[model samples]
Target: MILSRLSIINFKNIAQADLSFSPNINCFLGNNGMGKTNLLDAIYYLSFCKSYSHIADSQIIRHDEDFFMLQGYYDNNGNEEEVYCGMKKRQKKQFKRNKKEYGRLSDHIGFIPLVMVSPSDSDLILGGSDERRRFLDLVISQFDKNYLDTLIRYNKALAQRNALLKQEIKDAALYEIWEEQMSVTGEEIFKQRKSFLSTFIPVFQEFYTYISGGNESVGLSYRSHHEHGELFAQLAEVRERDRILGYTTRGSHKDELEMTLGEYPMKRIGSQGQNKTFLIALKLAQFDFLNRNGFTSPILLLDDIFDKLDSQRMERIISLVSEERFGQIFITDTNREYLDEIIRKTGHDFHLYQVIQGNIESLKEEK
Candidate 1:
């Protein structure tokens, strides 16, 4: 799938902007704080219905603006689609497709698949388990709509059960009802997550080998609070403990995806370079999986990918991209020299845009 055009108004530092995009490669080049990243973030928001850089939708609105609007036209899996997002500083954001409002965010989820590789990817190795869990959940949610529905229902049940636990319930019978509901939803979540990992792990194994030149053996495992075969039974056993703790404790909500390298945990054993490579490989693996599954390959967003890589590593990555194997790519960098080199070597058709202080302009090839 390809994003043919994007329009942004009052988003971050960008007061208003519209840019036509190429199907293959689109480069956003500028110095620091020039809003190059914001352009990519806008496209991402249109696709995902949220921002990658910030949690609050209000923060995406430019200063003094009451709201922000972003829209895009995409050729999604051979279907032409239009999507729009509008957010107010004090109200919830709204999403629409084909000019009709989407009643639930889940209705719009995964309509456009995306794979973002930002500088903060080191969090996969160094950050807490929640980060990795979130990565897995979001990616899997895109691939499995039923998984997304189950996840949403499970989270709602969990929240309500936690709130009930904190209440002064005189009757123990009420507690039983909530417990039964929570256990049912939680078990479904656990099962879906385990099934997802069963499919995802082999893909990772293959791509990790491809990206690492067959030298490093990479692996991923799912860690859950319940035993592999006893998810429901474990939740039942934890009822008393959960009641005392005022929250449900054992289920997919507390699961993790652990990354390892050659029998050693990557968090401790992998170098910074290795971590970055692994994250990139993980994204590439996702791309391949999506392509094979008949979903459009995600729009690949690379932010400052060249900053942490040597020329050789950068060349390898560029070679893979230039193989004309992926979908729309939006990449950002401070210097255009490296990109120029890749263009010369690969001869791929790409549009170069110069960004400065929230403004963008297409640059002509130097004669």
Candidate 2:
């Protein structure tokens, strides 16, 4: 899939702009706070129907502006596909495909599979387990609609069960209802997650090896309560403890995707470069996985990710993606030299743009 054109209006710091994109690589060059990342986020929003950093829709709109709009023209396997997103303060957000608005936003996912690697992704390593769980969900959801729906149902049931736990009555019968639902849905989620990781971990390790030059050994492991026994039995055993804790304690929500360097946890032992390398490898693995499963290469987004890496590592990454295995890519960086080097190395068609205080201008096109 290729994003051939992008049009933005009142989206974050970008006030008004309409730009075409190359099928191979598109680079945004600018300094910090100059809206380079914001431009990439706009493309992300078109794919996922939400901002990567911002939580509230209203916050994404340009300050002092009432609304924001984003549109993308894509070429999917020779067919023209257009995605449109519009939002207003104190109003509902609208998403459309080929000009027809979708009734549910979840339907838009997987239609345009994309992988984004940014400095913020370090949260997966340094942050809590919830961050890692989100990583798993985002990757799986793009390929498996059933897995996405099961996750939604599982969360709803877990919420209901937690709400019951907070009540004074503590009706066993009511608790059993949600518990049974949780067990069924949670079991499905656990199985899918387990199966996915079994396939994913090897790919992740491969990328890590290539990017890190095979000097450091890395590992990824999945941990879940399902391995002990049936989720129903486990939840039942934890019922009393959960009641006291006022939450559901035994479920897929607590699963962990542990990252390791050699035998120790990467978070504790790895340096800044190692951690960044780990994350970039994980994301590139995600791109490879999705491209293989989805039957088309997912658009790749690299958000200021070249920082803090040695020249050798950067060259390895560039060489990896410049191959025919990858598809259209969008990258952001503060240094023009790096972008120039990448453009020259790839020797592919590319478009370079300069971003300044929310305004964008096409710098040049390399053929």
Candidate 3:
């Protein structure tokens, strides 16, 4: 799948904008704080039914604006369809496909696949476990609707179980009910994550080899809080402590994806460049996985990533895009000269857009 057009109104810094995209590689080149990343965030919102940057939908609306709207046209398996989303403060966010309302956010999920490479993604390696967990959950949630439903139900059950634990109810039998539900849901989550990693690890390794020149062995290991062999029994053993803490403390949420370089933690041992490359490699692998499956080819969003790399690594990334490895990428920079330099060396199909304040203008078209 590919986006053919995008329309934004009173969103972020953009007051009102509409632009057509090149089906091959549409590039957005502009300086920082010019709403470059915000533009890509709008596209992401349409695909995932939420903003990529903000936790709340109201944050996307322009200052003093009552509401905001984003619409995208996509070519899905040779059939054209339109996805529209509208957000307002103190009101519900609405989503529609082909002018018909969607009943659930899940209905619109994964209709369009996307892989984003932001400067903040380096956190996936160096940051806390929650960050890595989010990385895994977002990717898996998109491809598997069942996983999404299970995840939602698991979280709800976990919350209710925790709330009950905090209360003064003397019903010791209630703890058994929570444990059984937690075991079932947590086990499903663990199994799906393991299955996904089985597919993901090889792809990640191959990418790391390519990007790192095969110098070091890159590894990803899933480490759970409880032994998979003893998961149920362990949950039973820890029930007392969990109730004292007022939470389900030993489940999938406590599991982690460990990133290692050679024999050391990538976060501690890898250099800045290595960390950035690893992050990019992981995202590329995600793109490849989605592409290999029947899912849509993701539009690569590189948000000020050039600023975080050296010329060598920058060229490496440019080569990947130049080789047409990623479909329809949007890149941002603080200076036009940076993009101009790469554009000078690489002869590829793309368009340049000049962004200032909330306005955007395309410079040239593919000939």
Cα lDDT listed for each candidate: 0.79, 0.90, 0.80
Residue-wise C-alpha lDDT for candidate 2, range 1-367, written one tens digit per residue = 9999999999989999999999999999999999998999999999899988847889999999999999999999999999999988999999999999999898888899999998889899999999999999999999999999999999999998888788844677888888888889988989888898888889988998998899999999989888888888888788888888898888899999888999999999999999999999999989988988995789999998889899888889878878877779899999988788878887899999999999999999877
RMSD of each: 2.3, 1.0, 2.0
The alpha-carbon lDDT assigned to residue 224 of candidate 2 equals 89
* Descending-TM-score candidate ranking: 2, 3, 1
lDDT of 2 at 340: 82
Candidate 3: tens digits of C-alpha lDDT, residues 224-315: 85455555677677667876887777788888999998888999899888888888889888888877764567777777776656677777
Candidate 2 lDDT score at position 32: 96
lDDT of 1 at 336: 89
Candidate 2 weakest ten by summed lDDT: 164-173
Ranking by lDDT: 2, 3, 1
Number of the predicted model whose lDDT against the real structure is largest: 2
**Which pairs clash in model 3?**
none
Q: Can you list the residue pairs that collide in candidate 2?
A: none
Clashes of 3: 0
Per-residue error (Å), model 1, residue 69: 0.8
